[model samples]
Target: MRNPSLYLLPALIALGANVAVISECQAGGGGELTAAVRHEAELNQISMLEAESLLGQPNVHFFDVNTLEIWAEGYLPGAVFFNVRDWQKLLPAKKDATLVFYCANRLCTASVLAAREVMKLGYTDVRQMPDGVYGWRISGRPVEKP
Candidate 1:
C-alpha cells in the first residue's frame, strides 16, 4: 500500500494556499484598494492563519459580528457574540485592545461591517479575519456552539 503520510504534506500545502486565495478574493477587489476600505478596526489585515496565531496569544479577543442565531450555530473557539447592531455597547472603549472580527464565511459581509464599526468607535487595533467561520471550519480549527 502507498504510504499515507506521503500525501499529507502536499495536501496540507494545497489546502493552505486555497484558503489564502479565497481570503484574498473575498477582500473586495483583491488588492490595496480593498485594503483601503476600512473595516472598523485599523488592526493589521491578515489571513485566517495569522488570525489564529493572534488568537492563541493572551488577551486577544475574537468578536462574532453576526446575528444571534448564526453565532449560536457555530463560531471560532473563545469568540464572544456581539450583534452588529449593538456593537457600540459591546465593544470596549479602549483603542488599544487586540480585537478581531469575523462572520459566517469568506463571502459574508458581517465581518467587514463589524470591522468598520469598530473603527468608527475609535478602536485603534482592530482587524477582520479574512475567511471568517467557513475558513475556520475548513482549517480543522475548533469551534463552539451556544
Candidate 2:
C-alpha cells in the first residue's frame, strides 16, 4: 500500500501556503480586520479615497462606531454617532439608504461589527471604511469637532 503520510504531506504543504498568503495579505496594510470578519460581515470595504468621494453626496450617510468620548474628540464631517447599544433607534428609517460605518482605525473592528449588525437588521446598502477616521485625519481630510 502507498504510504498514507505521503498524501498528507501535500495537504499540509497547501495549508501552509494558504496561511502564508493570508499573512502576507494582512501584512500588506490591507486593513486589520481578518478574513473571517470580511466573510462573516459580508459588507463592502471602501478605501479612504472612496469614502472621501462619497462625502457631501446626497443619500450617503456616515456613522462613527467609536465610543462617545472618542467621537467627541473628532469624527468624519457629517457623520452621525452610532451607538451600538441603541442602534435600532438611531438607524435611518430607510433600510436601503447608503450607510458608511467607520471606527478609530484599521485596527478597530467596531465598524465591522456594526456593519454586520446593520446588515443583519435587513439594511440593503451597508459599507465599511476599513481605514477608519484615523486614516481620514492622517490623509488631511476634514474632521468635525463636537
Candidate 3:
C-alpha cells in the first residue's frame, strides 16, 4: 500500500515553508549577531597566541581589557588589567607602551575595541588578543589570580 503523505509533494513543500518561517522567527536575532561576529573576525584582528608569542619579545605589554570582577577571577600571568569602560583615564598612562589587549575570550569584542583605543592614544604598537584570556588558560600557558 502506498502512503498518501508521500504522494503529497505539494503538502510537504507547504510544511517545509512553515517550518522555515517558524525557525527564522526564532533564530533571526541570534543569527544576525553571529554573522556580525564572524565578519569582525574576518577583518583579521589580532589573536591571543600572536600576542603571547610577541610577549616573549621585548617591548610588548599584555593588557587585560576585562572588568575588575573578571580580572580578579584569574588572568594570564604578567598581564596588566585595565577596565575598557574607563580606558581614557588608564590608557593614557601607558600610551607609549607596546600594547596587546585581551578580554574574556575569542568571541569577545572588548579586546579589539581596547586595541583601537590604544592606537588612538598614540601607541604605535597595538594589537588585540582575539582568543583572549580563555585561550591563554586553556593552552596550558601560565596564569595568576589574586
**Top candidate when judged by lDDT against the true structure:** 2
lDDT of 3 at 111: 80
Candidate 3 per-residue lDDT, tens place, 91-120, comes to 535555677778998788888777765665
Q: Candidate 1: worst 10 consecutive residues by lDDT? A: 33-42
* TM-scores for every candidate against the unseen true structure: 0.64, 0.70, 0.59
CA lDDT for candidate 1: 0.78
Q: Give all candidates' CA lDDT scores.
A: 0.78, 0.89, 0.72
What ranges in model 2 sit over 4 Å off?
Answer: 1-41
Of candidate 3, the 10-residue stretch with the lowest lDDT total is 35-44
Residues 1-146, candidate 2, lDDT per residue (tens digit)?
99999999999999999999987664535566654434454679999988989999988899999998889889999999997566778788999989999999989999998899889989999999998888888989899998
Which should have the higher lDDT, number 2 or number 3? 2
How do the residues 7-89 of candidate 1 rate in per-residue lDDT, one tens digit apiece? 89899999999999887664444545433555333446668888878876765788987778888878988888877555577
Query: Global CA lDDT of candidate 2, please?
Result: 0.89
Error of 3 at 117 (Å): 1.4
lDDT of 2 at 16: 100
Clashing pairs in 1: 39-115, 39-116, 40-115, 40-116, 40-119
Model 2 residue 89 distance off true place after TM-score fit, in angstroms: 1.5
